[model samples]
Target chain A: MDIATQTETAPPPPPPATTEQQRASRGATRPGDRIFLGLSRGSGIVLLVIMAAIAAFLTYRAALALSDNTGNFLTTFEWDANAIPPKFGIAVLAFGTVVSSIIALVIAVPVAVGIALFISHYAPRKLAVPIAYVIDLLAAVPSIVYGLWGALVVAPNLTGFYSWLDTVLGWTGIFEYQGGAPRSLMTVGILLAIMILPIITNVSREVFLQAPKMHEEAALALGATRWEVIRMSVLPFGRSGIISASMLGLGRALGETIAVATVLSPTFLISASLLDPGGGTFAQNIASKFNEASEYGRDALIASGLVLFLITLLVNGAARMIIARRKEYSGANA
Target chain B: MSTTAPTAQAVTPDTLHAARLPRWTSPLVAIGSAAAAVGIGLAAGLHSRVQWGLIAAVLFVIASYVLATAVEGRRQAKDRFATSMIWVTFLLAVIPLASLIWETVERGSKVFSPYFLSHSMGVVADQDPGGGINHAIIGTLQQVALASLIAVPIGLLTAIYLVEYGRGKLAKAVTFFVDVMTGIPSIVAGLFVLSFWILILGFDFSGWAGAMALSILMMPVVVRSTEEMLKLVPNELREASLALGVPKWRTILKVVLPTAIGGITTGVMLAVARIAGETAPVLLLVWVNPFINTNPFDGAQGSLPLYIYQQYAAGSEASYDRAWAAALALIGFIMILNLVARGIARWKAPKTGR
Candidate 1:
């Protein structure tokens, strides 16, 4: 009786002891554990530091360039950064980037989705496997190679098609072609469309393949044709997936550098017609001018790159947000 | 309201008949569309074969739908339309990409010789015919090696931390930033290194500067892929090791890591392939060299992609051929990497339930 009373009166044995024991059991007391943890955690911290450094340094250079700016940074159309006063702006860059990427997304997304569905659902197993493999291989083809091909082979071949577009869609101001080299924003858009196709198709194919098989079977059992089944079951389930996939493609299209640089004959003016061989994307502008750019000129280019960086960040962040939000009701967790 | 016998008979008849089109219907429509398209092209004096193809595809789709509707009703027609559209789109996408590959091989083969492979652009002018990518190949190997050296260990460790020990806010923040980093433009990455390493630190153009930028782009891809690979390691293995009184670090290193090593290696190689093709960073930082310089730390380097870009910019028939040849080499290198990575993945896939 006395021992029991003494144990009961031991003042709960101190809560810190439990946590300390837990920590020790977690291997916190061992040097190997502590060192490994520290190393890995430090690596994570370093990665974060690098990301932070990218933004910070870009912004710093951008600030230096912006402070001496002799033009409205967002609205000025000219880009004579190497001049004594150094007047430069991202107006043409922003317009070109957004417009060309929009065109790419517009041209790529539907066809990509169709191709994805064809591979995932419509194609026979033998054909599907090889085509999917081909797409994957295509994805690995370097952008520089694509750019080279676009310049040499594709760009020359596009003239006939551009003329056709011009004749048919000439009433639309954007299709007016005062043709010279066929190196224009429209060409960039088409090439980007081709570039982003594999990525979008790959992602959407995976999503379409993951659509609940039972839901598809349920639709089929109700006498729905293949198209109706896809409409009622697969498309609904894969909607958010398609959106995120398209956004990923858009992000790539917006930031694609060498390809745009190779294919676009950039000028400062944003022509109403996409067929005009003018207007500069941020990445393309940086690449085309960096070789000749002075120190301040480099900073001005960095300023433009900073914009491209922020735009991609926003686009990618929004894509992640969409995926995250959809995960809640996507039945994926279940 | 109808009697059960009549309703059942009606359903049976409808199910039995269902108005199917013959298998040859599609081929017939295709041939018809092609002829019609050719006739239309001739009549309209259309110069572009692309226009001919487009007209044929449209005609095929429309004709198939109309025939299906006439024979098999609206629902089957809709299905036929969708099927034809998907097939057309697939063909549309595949044709241009195939042409790209075909053109690369065809043009590249004209100048791609052992002589081209063994020499460098030491004496050849842009318009001259005799030059090789030996220097470029060396530069690319060194820079990619440097980038992989920097990226792999850090990326692997970061992924290990996230998978094995990550808990609260720091882990969350790291994960988020890794995603953000993945989308950083290659050119932007170059700009960052330019601003920090070159502009502020007063560093000269070197392969080392380019490697730093390439590593920045490579690190995120490495981390993401390694994280995925690490996550694939079953929890049972880790738990079993811990239950044996092994320290958590040892368990992760000896048990979890070995089990996941194949996938991790594949991820690293794939990351290497990706960085190998990067041109913007090299363009910005490495500043091209025509002659072979083995020392990346001291001087400008010649890389395959940069070589291609420069050659293309030279705007000569000879340079264009050189560009195509270099592109072929780069593509072959990346394709080999991808194929090997995938081969490893298949060979070392986790033996679940075996």
Candidate 2:
């Protein structure tokens, strides 16, 4: 309670004000303080500048591409940037990026939470430690390796599964699969789900471990079952943490390049069926197309990249906000 | 004994012990479910083993819950059901991850060799039997090292600012934007550098361009990790140092940094590992060249991840083998970095309880 209120009313921490307060209270300032302060503050300023520069430069280049476009930048489907009147749009890329990320999130979040809960609550101490460690290592595995694995092993192995889905859910149109290699958004999404599971699990595991012990004990004292104790105490406490973790995973999925590029067969058109082969995400589009693009074509890809940047930015910002707000309510400054 | 017996009798025997499933029931149910699922799969002509597993999993939950509910009651059954689901989820995640590791090792070992490590794909065609990642390894080392050089100090200083002197709007904004920067897609970072350093500055594709993009990704990771490490330093240590008339900067440099150096190194190493695997930025900026180019500032270079991508894109049996081999090497490098970083973290964890 005291911690919560202290943070609530805390004054902003300006250095000079802090120094003056300190001197008035007990200590004296020293000589090299000014230069050191400038250097450190300069570093912080540089970081902000980098952020601003990224946004500014991307915007400038995106505008250059958008101005020469013969089609609506947001709606048109074609990507013929090198033509006399350049015509391109991000509609398909936007649809593919969002859909694939949503698919990843849907498949990943619940399983990630379960794993997190398993590590934090269910597993024995000896097993939990190693499992957690393994998850961390998995999280550190490179995206390209995942891409290679997805392309070579997962895609081929998934053909039967895709056919099953087509038979089971073909009426929905979303699961309709034409006879081909199973290089589709569904495959990309599933691969992304695997790629990001470790990250979400690791983060939510930390949060679940941090859930206050007293509440769980209290629930147990009320004759709650193990699952009941978790539902009453742990899940509520970790909900925000889980949300933020999922958001982080979502950010990654949206921006993932090589994995999608490796797995998904690239086409400009937006496909209604995730199991069918023709869709393109922003990052994958840029990676696959950038090599063959002209200078103007490159700028057009940059414009799509800017959209991806904005999306991930918004996702990460929301996650940070959730974490920050949780601090105020929980009195636990993460 | 007689008095205790009477008291125990006063409490109804049925109330004393609620019905419960036998201890061995879960495994029995799991086996039953698996047999049932396999039988059903065979009869239905289902080809995918994954479908069988899914069917088995669903049967296990249903059979366990039904058996439990019939005997122990609904509440206990619900608990058992949740336990089974959690286990299923964990196994589901683990299977693919283990498969990835297994596949990489099994397939990768077919072509992996010291010779494969030492040679380059410069002259070898995609279908050829002879080639290696020597040039890519060189390019990866140079790019990552250069990225580290650029990122570490700035990230370190920014972290110090946020931890030590930060208090007002500037600090808050920096903190917020640092979080935002953390999520910038690598390809966007590549695009940023493409626009600023290459496109606007008129520089050709080089390892330097890739490094610039990589450092952008690396910086935020470094700052976030270092900030956490710096925050872990006890305030009393700082107070004691300041009370002795040591300057603020000196105290920070001499005391706090020494205390946190292990963690900082681990953070930086982890950041390096992350960027080393990054293919998008390098794919955009470096423009993979199969031959070795030791000079980062000069021209196109090959990186381990980009090499894997290029080989995999080539679409041949030989190229696939090479790709897998390079992937194994890349994973090996990253795993080593991660292991070392975690080792340092464990080793340098504050020695308390003395």
Candidate 3:
């Protein structure tokens, strides 16, 4: 009884028409606000639903290929998808994708970083904008154009380089040439590198440009040369961004189709030598076989595509995580 | 900010002091001038031999400018060197674009007559490959339009959701997945559609399937571009609309969208241009029909990209010419769309006081 009386006495000090209560009462009937919130929430839900649907559809179809008896899908190399028992696997495709993309990264990253650094630090203001524009134009060039150019111009020119590599570095398995004209993994890698170079360069240039001017000046003031200043100030600040850019380029290279198909003449075998003119990527296999594929053959190709899709997804996801963590490095904020 | 000035000042002093020393400055300039003169004389002699005087002169000028920069201090020589480089970069970009355009126009001029537009490729045979791209043009329009219809709304809505309401786990997952989708190869997308719709579901090669494949490529681009444009929309507009008791979707459609319409159109046009040139995916999913098919769900249909691919694959000189013509036509269409997008952006951009 005493507690109840004390509580009542204390609460009675504030009127029934308190400010908070009045505000809450007034907010309850705001149908317009509720409607807006509902719409926004509904749109988000719809996006989630669509993503779920895509996953469901892909998994449902992928199941057909996965259910078949094969000695695990990743180990076997023969893509005799038309066999009555259908013995097939993705080892060649996986090897091809990883090898080509790795080569592309190896070739593209250094040049891309150099060009980015040149543009951001060395080039004068008048030259910088135009160079940047050129890079943008390069990025906008269609993949088919690049493929056509690669097939006609680059492939023919690579024959000389391939022979040179064979003559010089033949002891290393990777550079050993089996005397193919020009259709080889090395040529494909070069084409992939050219295709992805613009993207990596553009992203890295933006990141490098965003490096703190004061930090650079500080390094310079300590008697560091221009290159040393860049090394001390820009490289550390933009390292994660450069990684993200390379990952994005790698993702694109891994999944590129027409260019790989046009440039590579695969013989359905894997070799350590990039000059062997063998091994097929998932995208290249799908493109080459889709025109005349039988039913089971199509399913097998789709299964390979599923693997490619998952790999690209993993790569892009990692890129996004890196980019997200290093958002401050991006020039957009500046 | 205040601290930055001292370091900048300190760095500038040593470089400035070194620059002021004028060590071997006049001799360096004289030697550079002499080298330039010799180079010009040699180039002129070669030009006389080759009958290319203009090329020689331009090369001489470039060589002189580079030499001047090396001999002179950067402050005196940087401008000319930088200007020359800018021009070189511009030329590098313009040359291919111009060559591509010129080659296409030269080849396509043979078939740019009115009848070429009216007649279908059905009449043309391998023996005499000179009918028209009428069927291909129609098929391309229909398929790309259908792809846009499928991709645009979904992509735009997803972008809207991502930009406006997305916050936690689902949004991050969707963003990550969309990035993955963006990197997917066009041929693989075709394979996915072909296996699912044709092989498993027992459907035939139709324009609908081709559109589906294109949508797979187009969707992520549209979503990414639209999301970027939407993000550029100011947050104050949303708050203002919300304060005025407007529904969120309505505000997005009316206020946010109108504000970003210019960028959105550009993004959409770019996406269309991107998918329109896809050959591998359409080749895999849709059969090449000689005649036009209006119904996307019906029989096979021809598209510009596939037409070009087929003609080039024929490995004949005449067919290669036709391929170049088709390439021209595709480039023309994309350029027109780009021009229109630019025009729209210019028209819609907010006016500012002069």
Candidate 4:
């Protein structure tokens, strides 16, 4: 009777005892635990510091370049940063970068969304897996290889198409091709469209695959056809995913260096016709000019690189924002 | 669009009302449209296959819609149009991918002899070109290996913190910046390293400098992928190990890591493949040397991508052949890595490998 009374009196002793034991065992200040935690935490901190360092170094160098620039940095198309009384600007680079990437976006997004739908919905089970795998491997092809092929094979083959466009759509001005080898902004855009295809397809395909089976079946049972089912069920569900995927591809097209460097027969002026071989991208400009550039010239390239950096950051940031905002976006559980 | 089946056959049963075009309808229409496209392409004197493909795509979509509308109804017409468009898009993508691989193999094969792999570019001129990638191969292997050595530990540790112990503002900042870092252009990474290592500190051109830039490009990929892999290790394992009186670190080291090792390794390999073909950064930091360079710390080194770019820029038949061959080598390396990574993932699970 005494022992039972004692046990009842010491009610819930194990809870407090366990808490104390856990505190003692998992020690707040044990050297090993503290050190391990600190080291791992320190690694994360180091990554942040490295990012900060990149921004700082680039900003400082860019500022130095701007200080030496004789012409308006944003307006002038001239790139004589190495010349005496140097005058240079990023106008041409920015223009080409935006124009080419926009072209890539226009060309790639719709096609990518279509291909994603085909892989996710239209393809037979066996065909879909193998096709997706092949596309993934294509995505792994290096930019330099693309550059070589673009310069040699694709460039020559594109001549017929360029001439055809010129003859058919000459009134548009943008399609007016001079009888030169097809090293133009249009060609770069097409190449980038091809290059970014796999990424957009992969992302959009994943999103489409995640569409709710219940929703699809519901649409079908409502007497909707296959395309109607996709329109009513899958399209709305994967909209944000497709947008972000397109944006990621845009980022890649903007920053692409070697391929553009190899394919474009660059001139300093921004050509009104994309079929003409003129204008320069930020990355391509930096790379093509780096070897012969003086210190100030490199700094100028760094300034343009800074602009490209900021642009990509904004694009990727917007993508992340859309992805985050669409927390209720995916319809897999609906 | 009218419900033609229901209205036209009011006396018929609902079974007739819910009819769709037969499965064979699509295949037959596709073949018919393709034949028409070929006839039209030949008649119009269109030499490019791309034009023929476009015509076929257009014809197929039109035929699908027309046939489906005639047999089924308007809703089925729209459905067939979408399916046809999607299939056309798939074919469009396949054109470039198939051509790129075929052209590379067809052109690159002629030059990819064992002698080409083992020889150096020292004695051969760009115009006179009989040379190999022996030097570039060594440099690429060393630089990429060194980068992995430095990046794996730091990236792995950072991922562990994020998955296991991350809680407050600092962790949030790290996550945001890591995302930002992943999108940082390769050129910017090269520029940053150039300023920090060679310009500010007066270091000379070397493979180590290139490695530094490559590591920056590589680190975020490693962290993101490893974080995913580590997160996949269930908390039950951690709790179970801790309940047995194992230290937190030991529990993570023994149990969590072993579970996630395959995925982490795959991530690392993917990162390797990404950085291996990087040319812009290598162009800036490591000046290419034609001779065999065993030492990456002290002098210029040849790299495969740089070799491709340099050779292509030379604009000679011999140089182009060499460039194609090097490109083939680079593509081969990357594809093999990706395939192996896929194999490892499949080894763990038949699905969800990505």
Candidate number achieving the greatest DockQ relative to the actual structure: 1
Model 4 misplaced regions, further than 4 Å: A1-23, A328-334, B1-19, B349-354
lDDT of each: 0.90, 0.90, 0.73, 0.86
User: Candidate 2 chain B — worst ten consecutive residues by lDDT sum?
Assistant: B345-354
Report the C-alpha lDDT of model 3 over A1-334, residue by residue, as the tens digit. Answer: 1222343445445786555554443432357645654554554455455445545556666677667736467888687776667778888888988888899899888777777776788778998877776665556556665565566555765666677788999998889986756777778887788778788988888889889888898987886656667778899999998999999999889988877877788877888889868788888888877677666677777777777877887888788789877874454546
lDDT by residue (tens digit), candidate 1, B118-228? 899999999999899999999999999999899989999999999988989999899888987888889999999999989999989999999999999999999999899
Candidate 1 chain A weakest lDDT stretch, 10 residues: A1-10
Instruction: Tell me what TM-score chain A of model 1 achieves.
Output: 0.92
Query: Worst ten-residue run, lDDT, model 2 chain A?
Result: A1-10
lDDT string, candidate 2, A150-257, tens digits: 999999988887887999999999999887898899999999998889879987988898889899999999878898998989999999999999999999999999
Q: For model 4, report DockQ.
A: 0.66
DockQ of each: 0.73, 0.69, 0.26, 0.66
Q: Model 3, B1-354: lDDT tens per residue?
A: 999998997776554443332546435644555565557668656423222433443554465455556654454354444444434333434444454456567766765666766667786764365766788888889889999998887788778768876778868777776776777767767766776688668898888999988987888888898888788787777778867766566778898898888888888887888888888778887889978777878989888878876766666666666666777677778767766776776776532212
lDDT of 2 by residue, B1-354 (tens): 778988887785667578988889888988999999999999999877888999999999999999989998888888888898899888988888789899999999999999999999999998887899999999999999999999999999999999998989999999999988888889999999999888889999999999999999999999999999999888878878877767778988998999998899999999999999999999999998989999999999999999999999999999999999999999999999999998999899754324
How would the docking of model 4 be graded?
Answer: medium
TM-score of chain B of each: 0.93, 0.94, 0.78, 0.94
Fnat of each candidate: 0.83, 0.81, 0.30, 0.75
The numbered model that scores best in TM-score is 1
Off by over 4 Å in 3: A1-55, A69-72, A171-173, A176-181, A221-225, A328-334, B1-16, B19-119, B126-128, B244-248, B339-354
* Chain B global fold similarity (TM-score) for predicted model 2 against the true chain B: 0.94
Task: Please state the CAPRI-style docking class of candidate 2.
Answer: medium
